[model samples]
Target chain A: MTSDITLILRFLSILGGGAMAGILGSLTGLGGATVLVPLLTLFYGIPIYFATGASLISTIATSAGSASGYTKHKIANIKIGVGLEIATTAGAIVGSLTIVAVHEAHASWIIYVLFGIVLLGSLIPTIQRSSSEEPLKRKPDWTTRIFQLAGEYYDTKLKKKISYEGVRWWLAEIIMFFAGVISGLLGIGSGALKVLGMDWAMNLPMKVTTTTSNFMIGITAATGSSIYWYEGYIQLFIAGATAIGVVIGAYIGSRLLLKITNKNIRWIFFSILSFLGVEMLLEGLDKAKVLVIATTIEEMISIAVAIIMISGLYLKTRRGERAVKAA
Target chain B: MNVPSKQRDIDSITSLILRVGVLSSLSLIIVGVILLFIRGSADGVSISQIASFHSTFNSSYLNPTHIVQGLIAVDPLYFITLGLWVLIFTPITVVFTSMVTFITAGNRLYIAMSLIVLFNLFFAMLAIPSLIHT
Candidate 1:
């Protein structure tokens, strides 16, 4: 009876945790896998490999959940997304193969450390450009002309149709390959990298970049997950539960996103990223025998720090608002 | 069809495909999970074991035929897995749709591009994985 109770609790918690991660993902535009993997491996004591597989499988759920909404809005550039997918899928195949080789060599530590670095690296650019809603236009290049990389979408906030064209298609494609490899390697959709490829390299509008990147993530993740599925990495119950939970969370979050302010939430997100990033790095080092400590204590300290940082930011923002009112 | 109207048609069709695929698969998964809860075991595997990190259940051995077979047995695990398979194939269907849409629209470049993308998806999902396993 006690064992059955524990089983029920474990099942529920995994689903709940996945739902929370999904909410964060919807609000922040980062793939839920980035948060979900860390939550499972670091908090729940699941092995990183299993956690990654679960996360990867759940990514497909969120991608499917959101892609239709974006498609209906006609904000996602199907042409660009489909075009870039050619490279992403190819890269994903190579990346999954590389991970298989890495697993065979027992180099799991490398993946942990690399995932940490990638998570940390993505935070800076997100912090820098979180408020910017558009990208500066650039002149069309040869690849743009050949690919016909142009799109138009209605900007609800601006109440006008915005026309945009993407340039430097080769650059976007090259970056997309790297993004795909990251997706497969880390079992994430790597939306940050995809956005950077289109928004920065191709000079597309931010809306198009985000929606198109979201559109592309489903296929990119599917490519990687097939290999992971074959390798026995995906935990069926956990993955299934997480997938269902995340879809619910994403649905709720999409509604909440409009009601909440985005600015201060970004700072909170950055804090969590930094905390998880450092924790994963330490975990990798611990596994590599470069560092040794009680894993539970380390995880507790990281969570505490993240909580303190978030509260600190909240206080600062409130104080600033009071000051403005006084003036 | 003119350029703008053609674009609208593609967008509408694509949106409908996405909605139908995602919604149907999600509902199937939810029902499967609820059924699993009532049954408490699937295909000789207990819920406690299946929920564990070290679950030994190898789904790779379960192909489409096996899934169909299990469905007749009313195995919730196979139903859940089938739902997942549908989710994976949803994007593939979208890409295939785009291929046909472009072909009919007389967009030569997009037709070629979509075909390549479709080929890549097929290669990654079926061809390469099977090759590696074999």
Candidate 2:
């Protein structure tokens, strides 16, 4: 029998993933996959393999479950999501091979580097309004549109009609290819980079780009994860616990989202991502014998403290901290 | 533009809400039935997700069957089992979506129907694909 504590912890991890997804999702205007994989693997002690598969399943669940919400709200741009998916899916296919190779090699150093890069991609550029995007190289040509791709979602927050022009289509495609390689290699969702590619290269609205990125993630992870599943890297027990947990958590998170302000979610999300980055660097240092302190005990205590504090704050928030978090 | 002066009788709306809620639950059951019929096991249906479903359901030691030989199915027992699941879960899905809809639409019937369609669509996407894959 699964211990009650383990089940609780498992539930907490899933909920935490959903909450963080909501938090970062609104912050970066992207889905939770980018933050989930590393967070699960590094902090929660879920293996990277299982983390990737579960994260992908959760992405499907999160997107599938929430697609109705976004659609009802009319914030998801089907055109943009579908259009960009061509590139993203292609990237995902490439990423599948890459992930298998790296995972098979079991190169710890490379994982550390990828983790740092993703962290850097996620953070380290707060000052820029909307984060400076790269210039679009060339627009997606006829081949892209032939698929009847391209869509638009309304940004209720901005209350402005936003349209997408896949600027620098070539550049974005290139990055997406690399992003796919990274996603495939690292078992990471690559949402952070995918968002950057869209926002910077395509010059799409941030919210639209982020939502579209969520739409794109399932297939990307699916590509890599199928290979991982085939290779027997994925642990079904861990994946199921994580997947079921994530779905419930994500469901709750969405409910809370409609009630809560986006700003509060963003701040909490940024704080968490920053901490994950620091913790990862520390872990790398410890692994390399550059750091003296072991994180096992500290990790447990930190997690416990975070749970206590967050839960306490959640209760307070429920008790009527309805003053909206600032935008 | 003035919002349309739409008023609904409370009783009528309440009945509509109840009806929609029941329909949504039934719709989910239909989906669950379809899914279970396709891929669910004769002995037991496991999640398309490989390991997690069996672990959670099996670990219970309370699974109706002692040993779920294969993936779970929509046999005669499926309804007895899933009906209980929907009995518990449908209300949650309906109520949650109803609450969300109420926040937006003042019309209760609208809220309830919206909830039904919204949730039905959501699960169908997951269930249909899952059923096929499993």
Candidate 3:
């Protein structure tokens, strides 16, 4: 009887946790895997491997749930997403294989540190572009014409048809390969990297980047999942419960997303990115035993850094808004 | 300018495929969880054991044959596993659909692109894994 009660509590908490991850994942197009993994490992004491398996499952759920909505609304550019998958899928293969070597060498901390730095570094471009609704127009180059890297979507918030052409397709592909590698190695969707590739390198609009990144994530996760399945990383009950919860959360998030502005979405993305970035860096350092800071101090420091960065961006955006008004 | 009708068709179909896949998988998972709650176990494995964080009951032990047998026996765990399998395959199905659509639209570039992507997926999901296992 005691065991039964414990089972019920555990099951319910996992379900609830999954729903929260789904909401944030769909809202920001980060696939929630990054958030879900940490939540499960830190709070529930689930093993990192099982947590990652559940994260991958929930990532697929979030992607499918939200991408369907985005596709119906024509916000996700399928053509561009499909074209880019070639690189990401190939990268996933390489990354998955490389993880075996890393695991053998006990060098997983390198990946953790690298991921942390990349997340923090990507924030610079995000903040720089936050003030603008769309990227500056660039002449369509040869790669764009060949890849058909152009699309138009009706922005619900702006209430206008936004047509954008992606440039530097080769650069985006290179970034996507790295994104896939990160996804495969970490077992997270790595949506931030995909968004960076498209938004920063390809010069696509934020909505298109988010939705298309969401669309692309499902395939990427699927690739990683097959390998995880073989490795026996997936705990079925946990994954199922989380996947169901994430779908519910994603549905709610998709509805909320359609009602919000691009700037609002970027703020949400940035806030999550900052927190996760600092946390990952601290985690890597702690694991490597390079930082002797107490866990509490680390947590406090992460919160402090996130607060400072978010407020800094907020103030910058406010000043930019004021300048635009003055002009 | 409006999106080309051909592109619009592809988008709608992709959305439909994803919607159907997710909803069906969700229903299966929900039913499986409900059944597990009522029964308090599956295939003689108690709920506590199966749901435990460190549970050894995972995808590695269950093959397709085992899943089929479990499904035939109406095991709730198998239902959940089946749902996950559906969820995993949904994106692959979408890719296949898009490839066919591209072929019909006579876009040579996209057909080749889609083919390469599809092949990569197969290589990762099937070819390389099976090779490693053997």
Candidate 4:
């Protein structure tokens, strides 16, 4: 009975967290983390480290969920995302290796600094007025110019042609380089940087900027995630729960977008996240002492179960490989 | 002379739809790039956004052996081999992956419900000069 209640509570927290993440994530263009991580840690009393691990799972979930919607709409720009991924993925590996090295030293200060930064960011609105008004000057780049990197988007509202030329590809590359480094080093995604890089240097439209930033995050996170797993930072049970929740949340949220006005959605969404962001900042500050939980038997079982699944996959792969050889 | 519609036609239509879908996604990426540039300096874009989330959660990820590292005596250097795959396929895979997602979740009912809310929001937001400017 006690276990049942814990499970129920767990389910509810994740569901609620996911719901909040979906609404606010779409609104703020900051993805779901703007609300999820804080909701888990501050409201539900999930630890920050654990919350972050869980956040990564949800982040991937939201990405996966949105990937389908964006694909249906034909707006994800997989080519550009893929091209930039080469740089980001490589950087993630190095970033993960760095985190593993730093784990031994035990840095809480870094989290504090990161929290301060997010607190500062959460308050600010996603400024877009100038984005529409300014006559964009495409910063010349050999790669962008040669490749005709500029692209166009239809304003659903304006119902007219809105086009932009590529800005400073070199600058974007450099920003991604650092973003990748941070992705691995902190076990945090590089969406913030990728969005910023493309925006400031490339001059993409706002929706396009937000979506592509979302597009580019998968590889970087996946790269860093692989490294983090080897070094033993992720707790599978927590991550699994979080991942499932976020995927569902993002799906529902995007679907809800169909009903909600984008402007109202953005306003309500940012307002909620901003509220949650402040709450998170306060909780993080109040709790100075850190508590590290031991990995549970449930997680061990989860890993064991996964191993069984992998062995099955391996046998299949071997049989396929052998058949090819025979052919 | 006009040809009759057939299963092949539906398949071809779907394929074209998929192509257009991917093209649209690519277009959004382009637009998104411009939005980011006009908003602020590139450094501010990603770093601050990332810091915003990281600061809130500050986590250490777990290292999984078999799943990530692939330790169970497969081919030699399996992880290295997988890393090679990541090197090649991450970007394009997301596109292909999106198509799969649409097929799995492509219900007109769900999509339509979601859009009613989405488009109205975007129309009002985009048309209003005040929100666009600030």
Candidate 5:
């Protein structure tokens, strides 16, 4: 338990995984903890309980690092974000309380199953809008005017200032509450759900959806993490390594984001989501004795499914492009 | 024009606070990790033991006073833990700053919303957690 060499190796390996998760998280607007949780649980053989704590702490790290840049650029709508935080922080309290019961009962399979479903479900919207960075234009509603949910940012990709207004503030708040609950229970930033709340329900631009979600995630994660801290879920060495590594990795990812096109990045993000979703589902099923297979075999099956899904996505996009040209 | 310019000032200040809070915490965490490895242990717990997921070191026992005491003793784990706390508190700090920002901007709606967020944060971070644990 006290070996020096083993300790160094563990630190390096966790750091590497956290870094990769950070890059994926920044590109996808899913916090690094989303990918990092699955990696620790499946690949590193860490307990899901401990992996969650590490993931939660690392999410704060990633969010804080990235939120600085997004807020500075004035893309993150502080007014809208704080308005929604009222709901999210309240939901986080409820989630943390619920998890204490779940943890006591040792019903972790439920978490894995839910995580799998959420990831798989989110992929649809990700794929549907992968080609278009512009959000669907919708007229501002009464909630929008009241909440002052409007902003303008210069899009480097479009090379012009784009002004957009968000509608359905109440809808965004409803979604944020659940997003916070998920963050508390799963120890993730739940940034994907936050993005969905704004991008889909509120009719915000993708750039704003992403940056604002990034800004909002820090508060939600913090609300959850304080509870995790009290519940004794955090391991100092593992969580610390993960947080530091993910921060460094997210920094690199934000730099790379300027050069890479969103479409290419979306593909990479979707593939990772598919692979992790299948892995979590199979693992949960196996744990529940619904089916049994060697862990290696499960990993292989997940890889195969990911490859097939990615290829199918590629073909569909290509066909769509062709149809658009042919028309 | 006046409102937009004032808003931008608040935004820039808020950004500076976030950058400092995050970067400093990261550095503290990194240093703490290095100390754990180089020292081969912290507070008599070996690095390998701490690195292991199953290590029985319960951070729940580390209250603010204990954390401060640990810091005095140069405990690597405490340093790392403090860093994590800093990371968590960063957003809460931002909420407070925003409250003040809204107050100065005379945005009554946002001030009320920010007050709710701040209340929730304090209740979660301090009041309820202590009540539950005790």
Candidate 6:
């Protein structure tokens, strides 16, 4: 009887954790795996392999739940998403296969460090571009024309239609390929990289970038999941709970996203990126024995950095708003 | 300028499929979990045993024959397994439908693009793993 209670409690905890990850993932287009893996492993004491398996399931749930809404609203650009997916899917296959070689080399720490550096580096652009809702218009290039990378969406917050075109399609594709490789190597949805591909390289609006990234994550995750399945990584109870919770959270998050401003969404994304970046960096350092910090201290440092960065950005944005008001 | 009607149709269809797939799988999972709670075990595996962090029993142990047997006997764990299979295939279904949609639209570029992605998915999910095992 006590065992039954314990089981129920564990199930609920997993469900709650999955829901939280789903909300953040759907909101930021990071596919919730970023949050889910850490939460399950650190908080619940689930094994990392099982946590990753559950995280993959949550990613699909978030993508499916939120992408449906985004599609119905015409916020997710299907043409661009499908076109770029060719590179990501191919990259995923390569990355999954490459993991064997990487594990054999015992060089997985490098990937963690590289991933951390990439996340931290991308923050500069995210903060710089936070003030603008849309990118400056540029002349359409051939790649954009050939790929048909332009679309307009009705922005609820703006109460108007926003038409935008993605340029530098080749650059975006290259980035997406790396994104897929990273996803396959790491067993997480590389949503941040996908967002960067579209938002930075392709010059799509944040709203479009996020929703489209969410749309693509499902396909990417689906590719990797089969491998995880065959490897015996998926724990049925954990995955079942996480998938259900993530779907509910993702549904709520997609609704919230439509109502929230792009700047607000960027703030949320920025905070998550900072936290994840520092966590990954510390994890890599600890594993490499380069800087042997205790896990508690490492977490404290990541939280502190995330808090400082988020507050700094908030104050900067407020000051800018005040200046505009005075003007 | 507005989105083309054909494009809109594609979006609606895709969204519908995603919604259906996710919800149906979710329902199946929920039912299975509930059943497990009432039954206290699934397929001779106790709840505690299957729910453990270090549990060795997983998707690897599941096979088509066992899944079919579980479905026939209304095994709770197998229901969950079936639900997972559904969830995993949801996006693959979307990709397939999108390819078909592109074909009907006669959008040559997207048709080729979708076919490439679909093939990649198949290769990664089925071909590569089977080849490696062999």
Question: Model 2 captures what fraction of native contacts?
Answer: 0.03
Measured against the true structure, the TM-scores of the candidates, in listed sequence, are 0.90, 0.57, 0.94, 0.59, 0.95, 0.92
Candidate with the larger TM-score of 1 and 6: 6
What are the chain A TM-scores of the candidates, in order? 0.88, 0.71, 0.92, 0.74, 0.95, 0.89
For model 6, the superposed segments whose C-alpha errors exceed 4 Å read: A100-125, A315-327, B64-66
Residues B28-131, candidate 6: write the lDDT tens digits.
89999999999999889889988998898887777634778898898998888888878878888888877887788788999999889999998988888677
lDDT, residue B122, model 1: 77
Residue A70's lDDT within candidate 4 is 55
lDDT of 3 at A244: 85
Q: On lDDT, who's better, 3 or 5?
A: 3
Which is the leading candidate under TM-score? Answer: 5
Docking class of 2: incorrect
lDDT of 2 by residue, B13-103 (tens): 3224323433343344344334543453333544332224223332122232321332243342343233223322322343344345355
Worst 10 residues of 6 chain A by lDDT: A122-131
* Model 2 regions lying over 4 Å from their true place: A1-23, A124-127, A131-155, A158-166, A252-266, A288-293, A296-327, B1-69, B72-134
Q: Interface RMSDs of all predictions?
A: 1.8, 12.9, 1.1, 17.0, 1.4, 1.0
Ranking 2 against 4 by DockQ, winner: 2
- On the 0 to 100 scale, the lDDT of residue B22 in model 5 is 82
Candidate 6 docking DockQ: 0.81
DockQ of each: 0.59, 0.05, 0.80, 0.03, 0.76, 0.81
Query: Which digits, one per residue and each the tens of the lDDT, describe model 5 over residues B1-134?
Result: 12388778878877888888888888888888887877888887766677777877756756655778888888888888788888888878888888887898788999999988988888988887778867
Question: Model 5 over residues A1-327: C-alpha lDDT tens digits?
Answer: 446777778888898999999988877778888899889988988888788888988888888777777778777788788899998888888887788778889888877887777777767767766366677678888987889887887778888777777898888899999988888888888888888888888888887887778778888888878778888888877888798788888888777765677787888888889999999999888887888999899989999999999899889999998988899
What's the CA error at residue A151 for candidate 1, in Å?
1.6
Report the error of model 4 at residue A279, Å: 5.1
Chain A TM-score of model 6 comes to 0.89
The local distance difference test score of each candidate is: 0.78, 0.48, 0.84, 0.48, 0.83, 0.84
Ten residues in sequence with the least summed lDDT for candidate 1 chain B? B56-65
Reference-based TM-score, model 2:
0.57
Off by over 4 Å in 3: A103-115, A118-122
TM-score (C-alpha, index-matched) for candidate 4: 0.59
